[model samples]
Target: MGNPKQKWTNEEEEALRAGVAKHGAGKWKLIQKDPEFNQYLHSRSNIDLKDKWRNMAAAVQGSREKLRPPRPRPVQDVPAVPSVPLQTPTVVPAPVIHESPADHVKDESGKDLPDAKNGPRYTELIFDALKDQNAMDISSILAYIEKMSDIPVPPNFRKPLGARLRRLVQQEKLEKVESSLYRLKTNTVETNASNQKDTWPRPHPPALYTKVGESLEEAAKTAAYKVVEAENKSSVAAEAIKELEKFSKMAEETDSILQLAKDIFDRCTTHGEILLVA
Candidate 1:
Protein backbone atom coordinates (compact mmCIF):
# COMPACT_ATOMS: atom_id res chain seq x y z
CA MET A 1 0.00 0.00 0.00
CA GLY A 2 1.02 3.63 -0.45
CA ASN A 3 1.87 5.88 2.55
CA PRO A 4 -0.76 6.00 5.32
CA LYS A 5 -3.27 8.91 5.16
CA GLN A 6 -2.03 12.23 6.69
CA LYS A 7 -4.09 14.45 9.11
CA TRP A 8 -5.54 17.73 7.80
CA THR A 9 -3.57 20.80 9.00
CA ASN A 10 -4.96 24.27 10.02
CA GLU A 11 -4.07 25.70 6.58
CA GLU A 12 -5.86 22.84 4.74
CA GLU A 13 -9.02 23.34 6.91
CA GLU A 14 -9.10 27.10 6.31
CA ALA A 15 -8.72 26.57 2.53
CA LEU A 16 -11.58 24.03 2.60
CA ARG A 17 -13.86 26.47 4.46
CA ALA A 18 -13.03 29.27 2.01
CA GLY A 19 -13.65 26.97 -0.98
CA VAL A 20 -17.04 25.90 0.49
CA ALA A 21 -18.05 29.59 1.10
CA LYS A 22 -17.24 30.46 -2.52
CA HIS A 23 -18.74 27.41 -4.23
CA GLY A 24 -21.36 26.22 -1.57
CA ALA A 25 -21.47 22.69 -0.04
CA GLY A 26 -21.46 19.34 -2.07
CA LYS A 27 -19.11 20.91 -4.69
CA TRP A 28 -16.06 18.95 -3.46
CA LYS A 29 -14.51 18.35 -6.97
CA LEU A 30 -14.77 22.06 -7.81
CA ILE A 31 -13.23 22.98 -4.39
CA GLN A 32 -10.30 20.53 -5.08
CA LYS A 33 -9.79 22.02 -8.59
CA ASP A 34 -9.86 25.66 -7.39
CA PRO A 35 -6.38 27.27 -8.12
CA GLU A 36 -6.52 29.56 -5.04
CA PHE A 37 -7.20 26.64 -2.54
CA ASN A 38 -5.54 23.73 -4.56
CA GLN A 39 -2.04 24.35 -3.10
CA TYR A 40 -3.27 23.89 0.50
CA LEU A 41 -5.65 20.92 -0.27
CA HIS A 42 -3.45 19.13 -2.88
CA SER A 43 -2.99 15.98 -0.76
CA ARG A 44 -6.78 15.67 0.15
CA SER A 45 -9.05 14.00 -2.45
CA ASN A 46 -12.67 15.09 -3.14
CA ILE A 47 -13.92 12.23 -0.86
CA ASP A 48 -11.72 13.44 2.06
CA LEU A 49 -13.01 17.00 1.59
CA LYS A 50 -16.65 15.71 1.55
CA ASP A 51 -16.15 13.66 4.74
CA LYS A 52 -14.56 16.58 6.59
CA TRP A 53 -17.35 18.97 5.61
CA ARG A 54 -19.99 16.40 6.81
CA ASN A 55 -18.25 16.04 10.21
CA MET A 56 -18.05 19.86 10.68
CA ALA A 57 -21.75 20.27 9.76
CA ALA A 58 -22.72 17.58 12.30
CA ALA A 59 -20.70 19.31 15.09
CA VAL A 60 -22.35 22.73 14.33
CA GLN A 61 -25.82 21.08 14.34
CA GLY A 62 -25.10 19.46 17.75
CA SER A 63 -24.06 22.81 19.26
CA ARG A 64 -27.21 24.49 17.87
CA GLU A 65 -29.39 21.73 19.39
CA LYS A 66 -27.74 22.20 22.82
CA LEU A 67 -28.40 25.98 22.85
CA ARG A 68 -31.99 25.76 21.50
CA PRO A 69 -34.79 27.04 23.79
CA PRO A 70 -37.67 24.77 24.97
CA ARG A 71 -40.96 25.18 23.13
CA PRO A 72 -43.93 26.75 25.05
CA ARG A 73 -47.01 24.53 25.74
CA PRO A 74 -50.08 25.39 23.67
CA VAL A 75 -53.21 26.72 25.44
CA GLN A 76 -56.53 24.89 25.09
CA ASP A 77 -59.26 26.95 23.40
CA VAL A 78 -62.73 27.22 24.98
CA PRO A 79 -65.62 25.93 22.85
CA ALA A 80 -68.22 28.53 21.81
CA VAL A 81 -71.89 28.01 22.66
CA PRO A 82 -74.32 27.61 19.77
CA SER A 83 -77.12 30.23 19.45
CA VAL A 84 -80.82 29.31 19.40
CA PRO A 85 -83.73 31.24 17.76
CA LEU A 86 -86.16 33.04 20.09
CA GLN A 87 -89.60 31.37 20.39
CA THR A 88 -92.90 32.12 22.18
CA PRO A 89 -93.07 30.18 25.45
CA THR A 90 -96.19 28.06 26.05
CA VAL A 91 -97.48 26.49 29.34
CA VAL A 92 -97.81 22.69 28.97
CA PRO A 93 -99.78 20.53 31.43
CA ALA A 94 -97.70 17.87 33.11
CA PRO A 95 -98.60 14.25 32.35
CA VAL A 96 -100.03 12.34 35.30
CA ILE A 97 -99.87 8.53 35.79
CA HIS A 98 -102.32 6.45 37.86
CA GLU A 99 -100.78 4.57 40.86
CA SER A 100 -101.78 1.07 41.94
CA PRO A 101 -103.59 0.79 45.34
CA ALA A 102 -101.18 -2.07 46.24
CA ASP A 103 -98.28 0.46 46.39
CA HIS A 104 -99.95 2.26 49.38
CA VAL A 105 -101.12 -0.86 51.20
CA LYS A 106 -101.11 -0.69 55.04
CA ASP A 107 -100.15 -3.25 57.69
CA GLU A 108 -102.63 -5.22 59.93
CA SER A 109 -102.93 -2.19 62.24
CA GLY A 110 -103.98 0.06 59.27
CA LYS A 111 -100.67 2.04 59.50
CA ASP A 112 -98.86 2.71 56.18
CA LEU A 113 -95.76 0.55 55.85
CA PRO A 114 -92.45 2.23 55.16
CA ASP A 115 -91.35 2.26 51.51
CA ALA A 116 -88.47 -0.15 50.89
CA LYS A 117 -87.84 1.43 47.47
CA ASN A 118 -86.61 4.65 49.12
CA GLY A 119 -83.82 3.20 51.31
CA PRO A 120 -81.22 5.27 53.19
CA ARG A 121 -78.67 7.14 51.02
CA TYR A 122 -75.57 4.95 51.52
CA THR A 123 -73.13 7.59 50.11
CA GLU A 124 -74.15 10.25 52.65
CA LEU A 125 -74.13 7.72 55.49
CA ILE A 126 -70.52 6.64 54.67
CA PHE A 127 -69.33 10.24 54.48
CA ASP A 128 -71.02 11.01 57.83
CA ALA A 129 -69.43 7.93 59.42
CA LEU A 130 -65.90 9.02 58.32
CA LYS A 131 -66.38 12.75 59.09
CA ASP A 132 -64.64 12.68 62.47
CA GLN A 133 -62.44 9.60 62.06
CA ASN A 134 -59.44 9.13 59.78
CA ALA A 135 -60.39 5.57 58.86
CA MET A 136 -62.69 2.68 59.78
CA ASP A 137 -63.21 -0.93 58.77
CA ILE A 138 -66.43 -2.11 57.13
CA SER A 139 -67.89 -3.35 60.43
CA SER A 140 -67.20 -0.11 62.31
CA ILE A 141 -68.69 1.93 59.48
CA LEU A 142 -71.88 -0.16 59.54
CA ALA A 143 -72.18 0.21 63.32
CA TYR A 144 -71.68 3.99 63.20
CA ILE A 145 -74.38 4.42 60.57
CA GLU A 146 -76.84 2.32 62.62
CA LYS A 147 -76.07 4.26 65.84
CA MET A 148 -76.41 7.70 64.27
CA SER A 149 -79.35 7.26 61.86
CA ASP A 150 -82.94 7.86 62.98
CA ILE A 151 -84.26 5.05 60.73
CA PRO A 152 -83.74 1.41 61.76
CA VAL A 153 -80.91 -0.42 59.99
CA PRO A 154 -82.06 -2.95 57.40
CA PRO A 155 -81.08 -6.57 57.94
CA ASN A 156 -79.57 -6.81 54.43
CA PHE A 157 -77.95 -3.35 54.55
CA ARG A 158 -74.37 -4.59 54.01
CA LYS A 159 -74.78 -5.68 50.36
CA PRO A 160 -76.08 -2.30 49.14
CA LEU A 161 -73.58 -0.40 51.30
CA GLY A 162 -70.69 -2.43 49.86
CA ALA A 163 -71.78 -1.59 46.31
CA ARG A 164 -72.07 2.10 47.16
CA LEU A 165 -68.65 2.08 48.81
CA ARG A 166 -67.08 0.53 45.68
CA ARG A 167 -68.73 3.20 43.51
CA LEU A 168 -67.42 6.02 45.75
CA VAL A 169 -63.92 4.54 45.69
CA GLN A 170 -64.02 4.41 41.88
CA GLN A 171 -65.10 8.06 41.76
CA GLU A 172 -62.15 8.98 44.05
CA LYS A 173 -64.52 10.33 46.72
CA LEU A 174 -63.34 7.62 49.13
CA GLU A 175 -60.25 5.38 49.41
CA LYS A 176 -59.84 1.81 50.60
CA VAL A 177 -57.18 1.09 53.20
CA GLU A 178 -55.86 -2.26 54.44
CA SER A 179 -58.23 -5.24 54.32
CA SER A 180 -61.90 -4.15 54.40
CA LEU A 181 -61.00 -0.68 55.74
CA TYR A 182 -61.99 2.64 54.12
CA ARG A 183 -61.51 6.40 54.56
CA LEU A 184 -62.67 9.60 52.91
CA LYS A 185 -60.33 11.46 50.53
CA THR A 186 -58.34 14.42 51.82
CA ASN A 187 -60.40 17.62 52.44
CA THR A 188 -63.47 15.52 51.68
CA VAL A 189 -65.56 17.31 54.28
CA GLU A 190 -65.38 20.62 52.38
CA THR A 191 -64.43 19.66 48.82
CA ASN A 192 -64.76 16.46 46.81
CA ALA A 193 -61.17 16.82 45.51
CA SER A 194 -57.98 18.13 47.16
CA ASN A 195 -55.18 20.26 45.65
CA GLN A 196 -52.41 18.50 47.60
CA LYS A 197 -50.14 16.08 45.71
CA ASP A 198 -50.55 13.40 48.35
CA THR A 199 -54.35 13.50 48.15
CA TRP A 200 -54.35 10.45 45.87
CA PRO A 201 -54.44 7.34 48.07
CA ARG A 202 -51.74 4.71 47.54
CA PRO A 203 -53.00 1.20 46.93
CA HIS A 204 -52.79 -1.10 49.95
CA PRO A 205 -52.93 -4.84 49.36
CA PRO A 206 -55.07 -6.94 51.73
CA ALA A 207 -53.44 -8.80 54.61
CA LEU A 208 -54.73 -12.09 53.21
CA TYR A 209 -52.94 -11.45 49.89
CA THR A 210 -49.65 -10.70 51.63
CA LYS A 211 -50.05 -13.76 53.84
CA VAL A 212 -50.61 -15.94 50.77
CA GLY A 213 -47.33 -14.73 49.19
CA GLU A 214 -45.45 -15.47 52.41
CA SER A 215 -46.97 -18.95 52.57
CA LEU A 216 -45.93 -19.63 48.96
CA GLU A 217 -42.36 -18.52 49.65
CA GLU A 218 -42.22 -20.71 52.77
CA ALA A 219 -43.53 -23.70 50.78
CA ALA A 220 -40.81 -23.19 48.14
CA LYS A 221 -38.14 -23.17 50.84
CA THR A 222 -39.53 -26.37 52.35
CA ALA A 223 -39.52 -28.10 48.97
CA ALA A 224 -35.90 -27.06 48.37
CA TYR A 225 -34.90 -28.50 51.80
CA LYS A 226 -36.70 -31.75 51.08
CA VAL A 227 -34.88 -32.09 47.74
CA VAL A 228 -31.53 -31.61 49.45
CA GLU A 229 -32.42 -34.19 52.11
CA ALA A 230 -33.38 -36.73 49.40
CA GLU A 231 -30.08 -36.16 47.56
CA ASN A 232 -28.13 -36.80 50.80
CA LYS A 233 -30.07 -40.03 51.45
CA SER A 234 -29.35 -41.23 47.90
CA SER A 235 -25.62 -40.58 48.37
CA VAL A 236 -25.61 -42.63 51.64
CA ALA A 237 -27.41 -45.54 49.96
CA ALA A 238 -24.85 -45.55 47.12
CA GLU A 239 -21.99 -45.81 49.62
CA ALA A 240 -23.72 -48.72 51.41
CA ILE A 241 -24.16 -50.58 48.11
CA LYS A 242 -20.43 -50.19 47.34
CA GLU A 243 -19.49 -51.72 50.72
CA LEU A 244 -21.86 -54.69 50.11
CA GLU A 245 -20.30 -55.34 46.66
CA LYS A 246 -16.79 -55.42 48.22
CA PHE A 247 -17.93 -57.96 50.86
CA SER A 248 -19.49 -60.20 48.13
CA LYS A 249 -16.19 -60.24 46.14
CA MET A 250 -14.25 -61.36 49.27
CA ALA A 251 -16.72 -64.20 50.02
CA GLU A 252 -16.35 -65.60 46.45
CA GLU A 253 -12.53 -65.71 46.78
CA THR A 254 -12.76 -67.62 50.14
CA ASP A 255 -15.05 -70.36 48.62
CA SER A 256 -12.60 -70.98 45.73
CA ILE A 257 -9.65 -71.46 48.17
CA LEU A 258 -11.62 -73.95 50.40
CA GLN A 259 -12.58 -76.13 47.35
CA LEU A 260 -8.89 -76.34 46.21
CA ALA A 261 -7.76 -77.54 49.73
CA LYS A 262 -10.49 -80.28 49.82
CA ASP A 263 -9.40 -81.58 46.36
CA ILE A 264 -5.67 -81.91 47.43
CA PHE A 265 -6.59 -83.89 50.62
CA ASP A 266 -8.67 -86.47 48.64
CA ARG A 267 -5.78 -87.05 46.12
CA CYS A 268 -3.30 -87.83 48.95
CA THR A 269 -5.73 -90.32 50.66
CA THR A 270 -6.29 -92.18 47.33
CA HIS A 271 -2.50 -92.49 46.62
CA GLY A 272 -1.75 -93.99 50.13
CA GLU A 273 -4.58 -96.60 49.84
CA ILE A 274 -3.22 -97.76 46.39
CA LEU A 275 0.30 -98.16 47.77
CA LEU A 276 -0.83 -100.40 50.73
CA VAL A 277 -2.98 -102.67 48.45
CA ALA A 278 -0.04 -103.23 45.95
Candidate 2:
Protein backbone atom coordinates (compact mmCIF):
# COMPACT_ATOMS: atom_id res chain seq x y z
CA MET A 1 0.00 0.00 0.00
CA GLY A 2 1.09 3.59 -0.72
CA ASN A 3 0.34 7.02 0.90
CA PRO A 4 -2.54 9.11 -0.56
CA LYS A 5 -1.54 11.65 -3.25
CA GLN A 6 -1.62 15.30 -1.92
CA LYS A 7 -2.92 17.92 -4.34
CA TRP A 8 -2.68 21.74 -4.10
CA THR A 9 -6.14 23.45 -3.95
CA ASN A 10 -7.36 26.51 -5.92
CA GLU A 11 -7.36 28.65 -2.72
CA GLU A 12 -3.74 27.63 -1.98
CA GLU A 13 -2.76 28.62 -5.52
CA GLU A 14 -4.47 32.06 -5.09
CA ALA A 15 -2.70 32.64 -1.71
CA LEU A 16 0.69 31.79 -3.27
CA ARG A 17 -0.16 34.14 -6.17
CA ALA A 18 -1.01 37.06 -3.83
CA GLY A 19 1.87 36.42 -1.34
CA VAL A 20 4.48 36.41 -4.13
CA ALA A 21 2.95 39.60 -5.59
CA LYS A 22 3.20 41.38 -2.20
CA HIS A 23 6.38 40.03 -0.53
CA GLY A 24 8.32 38.76 -3.61
CA ALA A 25 8.83 35.13 -2.37
CA GLY A 26 11.26 33.58 0.24
CA LYS A 27 10.33 32.79 3.91
CA TRP A 28 8.14 29.86 2.78
CA LYS A 29 7.44 28.59 6.35
CA LEU A 30 5.98 31.98 7.32
CA ILE A 31 3.85 32.14 4.14
CA GLN A 32 2.54 28.58 4.76
CA LYS A 33 1.10 29.59 8.16
CA ASP A 34 -0.56 32.80 6.88
CA PRO A 35 -4.39 32.77 7.30
CA GLU A 36 -4.84 33.32 3.55
CA PHE A 37 -2.55 30.35 2.75
CA ASN A 38 -3.89 28.19 5.66
CA GLN A 39 -7.48 28.52 4.34
CA TYR A 40 -6.46 26.35 1.35
CA LEU A 41 -3.44 24.26 2.45
CA HIS A 42 -3.18 23.50 6.23
CA SER A 43 0.20 21.73 6.55
CA ARG A 44 2.73 24.27 7.97
CA SER A 45 4.91 21.39 9.28
CA ASN A 46 5.54 20.12 5.74
CA ILE A 47 8.39 22.05 4.05
CA ASP A 48 7.86 20.11 0.76
CA LEU A 49 4.32 21.63 0.55
CA LYS A 50 5.76 25.14 0.97
CA ASP A 51 8.43 24.51 -1.74
CA LYS A 52 5.73 23.41 -4.23
CA TRP A 53 3.72 26.61 -3.53
CA ARG A 54 6.91 28.73 -3.93
CA ASN A 55 7.86 27.05 -7.30
CA MET A 56 4.31 27.61 -8.63
CA ALA A 57 4.44 31.27 -7.46
CA ALA A 58 7.82 31.81 -9.24
CA ALA A 59 6.42 30.46 -12.57
CA VAL A 60 3.31 32.68 -12.24
CA GLN A 61 5.45 35.80 -11.50
CA GLY A 62 7.80 35.06 -14.42
CA SER A 63 4.79 34.87 -16.78
CA ARG A 64 3.28 38.10 -15.33
CA GLU A 65 6.52 40.12 -15.87
CA LYS A 66 6.73 38.92 -19.48
CA LEU A 67 3.12 40.08 -20.14
CA ARG A 68 3.46 43.53 -18.42
CA PRO A 69 4.12 46.55 -20.71
CA PRO A 70 7.36 48.60 -20.44
CA ARG A 71 7.03 52.08 -18.88
CA PRO A 72 7.87 55.35 -20.85
CA ARG A 73 10.37 58.04 -19.73
CA PRO A 74 9.13 61.58 -18.81
CA VAL A 75 10.40 64.86 -20.44
CA GLN A 76 11.32 68.20 -18.70
CA ASP A 77 12.08 71.88 -19.85
CA VAL A 78 14.54 74.49 -18.37
CA PRO A 79 13.36 78.07 -17.40
CA ALA A 80 15.04 81.49 -18.32
CA VAL A 81 15.99 84.32 -15.78
CA PRO A 82 16.02 88.21 -16.28
CA SER A 83 19.10 90.48 -15.53
CA VAL A 84 19.00 93.25 -12.73
CA PRO A 85 21.18 96.32 -11.80
CA LEU A 86 23.19 96.50 -8.47
CA GLN A 87 22.62 99.30 -5.80
CA THR A 88 25.24 101.49 -3.88
CA PRO A 89 26.03 101.01 -0.13
CA THR A 90 25.01 103.64 2.55
CA VAL A 91 26.42 104.57 6.06
CA VAL A 92 24.21 104.51 9.29
CA PRO A 93 24.38 106.60 12.56
CA ALA A 94 25.45 104.98 15.95
CA PRO A 95 22.81 104.62 18.75
CA VAL A 96 23.10 106.12 22.31
CA ILE A 97 24.29 103.98 25.31
CA HIS A 98 21.55 102.76 27.69
CA GLU A 99 21.82 100.65 30.92
CA SER A 100 25.32 99.08 31.09
CA PRO A 101 26.80 96.45 33.57
CA ALA A 102 28.05 99.23 35.93
CA ASP A 103 24.59 100.93 35.80
CA HIS A 104 22.96 97.62 36.83
CA VAL A 105 25.45 97.18 39.72
CA LYS A 106 23.19 99.01 42.26
CA ASP A 107 19.56 98.30 43.17
CA GLU A 108 16.70 100.89 43.74
CA SER A 109 18.16 101.66 47.26
CA GLY A 110 21.61 102.34 45.62
CA LYS A 111 23.06 99.34 47.53
CA ASP A 112 25.67 97.13 45.75
CA LEU A 113 24.13 93.90 44.32
CA PRO A 114 24.65 90.86 46.58
CA ASP A 115 26.91 88.07 45.18
CA ALA A 116 24.63 85.30 43.89
CA LYS A 117 27.12 82.44 44.48
CA ASN A 118 28.28 83.39 48.05
CA GLY A 119 25.07 85.21 49.15
CA PRO A 120 22.07 83.22 47.83
CA ARG A 121 18.54 84.27 49.01
CA TYR A 122 16.81 82.36 51.83
CA THR A 123 14.75 80.12 49.45
CA GLU A 124 17.78 79.43 47.22
CA LEU A 125 19.84 78.50 50.29
CA ILE A 126 17.06 76.14 51.54
CA PHE A 127 16.65 74.38 48.18
CA ASP A 128 20.43 74.10 47.77
CA ALA A 129 20.65 72.57 51.25
CA LEU A 130 17.87 70.08 50.36
CA LYS A 131 19.76 69.15 47.18
CA ASP A 132 22.98 68.71 49.22
CA GLN A 133 21.11 66.38 51.61
CA ASN A 134 19.87 64.40 48.55
CA ALA A 135 16.21 65.36 49.13
CA MET A 136 15.68 64.50 52.81
CA ASP A 137 12.40 65.14 54.72
CA ILE A 138 11.35 68.79 55.32
CA SER A 139 12.23 68.89 59.09
CA SER A 140 15.63 67.18 58.78
CA ILE A 141 16.48 69.16 55.61
CA LEU A 142 15.49 72.47 57.27
CA ALA A 143 17.48 71.64 60.41
CA TYR A 144 20.55 70.85 58.31
CA ILE A 145 20.12 74.12 56.35
CA GLU A 146 19.94 76.19 59.64
CA LYS A 147 23.13 74.52 60.93
CA MET A 148 25.06 75.19 57.68
CA SER A 149 23.96 78.84 57.12
CA ASP A 150 23.09 81.93 59.23
CA ILE A 151 19.96 82.71 57.10
CA PRO A 152 16.64 82.40 59.00
CA VAL A 153 14.02 80.33 57.04
CA PRO A 154 10.50 81.70 57.69
CA PRO A 155 7.41 79.44 58.25
CA ASN A 156 6.06 80.46 54.81
CA PHE A 157 9.15 78.97 53.16
CA ARG A 158 8.03 75.46 54.28
CA LYS A 159 5.07 75.62 51.84
CA PRO A 160 7.43 76.49 48.96
CA LEU A 161 9.75 73.64 49.99
CA GLY A 162 6.77 71.23 49.78
CA ALA A 163 5.95 72.62 46.32
CA ARG A 164 9.62 72.23 45.24
CA LEU A 165 9.67 68.61 46.50
CA ARG A 166 6.49 67.89 44.51
CA ARG A 167 8.12 69.39 41.40
CA LEU A 168 11.30 67.34 42.03
CA VAL A 169 9.14 64.19 42.33
CA GLN A 170 7.51 64.96 38.97
CA GLN A 171 10.95 65.64 37.46
CA GLU A 172 12.15 62.23 38.83
CA LYS A 173 14.95 63.97 40.81
CA LEU A 174 13.51 62.96 44.22
CA GLU A 175 11.27 60.19 45.56
CA LYS A 176 8.70 60.38 48.45
CA VAL A 177 8.14 56.97 50.00
CA GLU A 178 5.76 57.97 52.85
CA SER A 179 3.81 61.18 53.75
CA SER A 180 6.87 63.08 55.09
CA LEU A 181 9.87 60.74 54.46
CA TYR A 182 11.89 61.25 51.28
CA ARG A 183 15.02 59.71 49.71
CA LEU A 184 17.27 60.35 46.72
CA LYS A 185 15.90 59.37 43.28
CA THR A 186 18.49 56.59 42.81
CA ASN A 187 17.56 54.67 46.08
CA THR A 188 21.13 55.06 47.38
CA VAL A 189 22.06 56.42 50.86
CA GLU A 190 24.08 59.62 50.19
CA THR A 191 24.78 60.87 53.76
CA ASN A 192 25.95 59.48 57.14
CA ALA A 193 23.05 58.91 59.58
CA SER A 194 24.89 59.48 62.93
CA ASN A 195 22.23 61.98 64.15
CA GLN A 196 19.26 60.07 62.60
CA LYS A 197 17.15 57.86 64.88
CA ASP A 198 16.78 54.08 64.24
CA THR A 199 13.07 54.12 63.35
CA TRP A 200 13.12 51.17 60.88
CA PRO A 201 12.89 47.57 62.21
CA ARG A 202 15.99 45.28 62.18
CA PRO A 203 16.18 42.26 59.84
CA HIS A 204 15.99 38.66 61.24
CA PRO A 205 19.00 36.34 60.94
CA PRO A 206 19.04 33.72 58.13
CA ALA A 207 17.88 30.30 59.42
CA LEU A 208 17.99 26.61 58.28
CA TYR A 209 14.98 24.22 58.11
CA THR A 210 15.57 22.95 61.70
CA LYS A 211 15.76 26.53 63.01
CA VAL A 212 12.59 27.39 61.04
CA GLY A 213 10.78 24.39 62.59
CA GLU A 214 11.84 25.46 66.10
CA SER A 215 10.72 29.02 65.38
CA LEU A 216 7.35 27.78 64.11
CA GLU A 217 6.91 25.62 67.25
CA GLU A 218 7.63 28.66 69.42
CA ALA A 219 5.29 30.84 67.34
CA ALA A 220 2.53 28.15 67.56
CA LYS A 221 2.55 28.49 71.37
CA THR A 222 1.87 32.22 70.94
CA ALA A 223 -0.34 32.03 67.78
CA ALA A 224 -1.58 28.65 66.44
CA TYR A 225 -3.38 30.04 63.31
CA LYS A 226 -0.22 31.77 62.05
CA VAL A 227 1.89 28.60 62.53
CA VAL A 228 -0.73 26.29 60.87
CA GLU A 229 -1.09 28.64 57.87
CA ALA A 230 2.71 28.78 57.43
CA GLU A 231 2.97 24.94 57.56
CA ASN A 232 0.18 24.54 54.98
CA LYS A 233 1.89 27.08 52.69
CA SER A 234 5.14 25.05 52.96
CA SER A 235 3.27 21.87 51.91
CA VAL A 236 1.58 23.69 48.98
CA ALA A 237 5.04 24.99 47.90
CA ALA A 238 6.44 21.41 47.90
CA GLU A 239 3.53 20.22 45.68
CA ALA A 240 4.11 23.16 43.27
CA ILE A 241 7.81 22.20 42.97
CA LYS A 242 6.86 18.61 42.01
CA GLU A 243 4.35 19.81 39.35
CA LEU A 244 6.94 22.23 37.91
CA GLU A 245 9.46 19.36 37.52
CA LYS A 246 6.86 17.29 35.57
CA PHE A 247 5.98 20.24 33.31
CA SER A 248 9.70 20.83 32.58
CA LYS A 249 10.12 17.21 31.37
CA MET A 250 7.02 17.44 29.13
CA ALA A 251 8.22 20.74 27.62
CA GLU A 252 11.66 19.24 26.84
CA GLU A 253 10.06 16.25 24.98
CA THR A 254 7.74 18.57 23.00
CA ASP A 255 10.72 20.78 22.01
CA SER A 256 12.71 17.71 20.85
CA ILE A 257 9.85 16.54 18.59
CA LEU A 258 9.43 20.04 17.10
CA GLN A 259 13.18 20.25 16.36
CA LEU A 260 13.17 16.80 14.66
CA ALA A 261 10.22 17.85 12.44
CA LYS A 262 12.06 21.10 11.55
CA ASP A 263 15.27 19.19 10.57
CA ILE A 264 13.28 16.73 8.36
CA PHE A 265 11.44 19.63 6.67
CA ASP A 266 14.69 21.50 5.99
CA ARG A 267 16.32 18.42 4.32
CA CYS A 268 13.23 17.42 2.24
CA THR A 269 12.43 20.91 0.83
CA THR A 270 16.06 21.77 -0.25
CA HIS A 271 16.34 18.46 -2.22
CA GLY A 272 14.10 18.44 -5.40
CA GLU A 273 13.54 14.63 -5.52
CA ILE A 274 12.43 14.54 -1.79
CA LEU A 275 9.92 17.40 -2.42
CA LEU A 276 8.40 15.48 -5.45
CA VAL A 277 7.82 12.43 -3.23
CA ALA A 278 6.46 14.66 -0.39
User: Candidate 1 residues 8-64, lDDT tens each?
Assistant: 775676567656534545567887887767877879899999888766554433343
- Ten contiguous residues with the weakest lDDT in model 2: 78-87
lDDT of 2 at 107: 37
TM-score of each: 0.27, 0.21
Give the alpha-carbon lDDT of every model.
0.47, 0.38
Off by over 4 Å in 1: 1-114, 117-120, 187-278
Clashes of 2: 0
Global lDDT for candidate 1?
A: 0.47
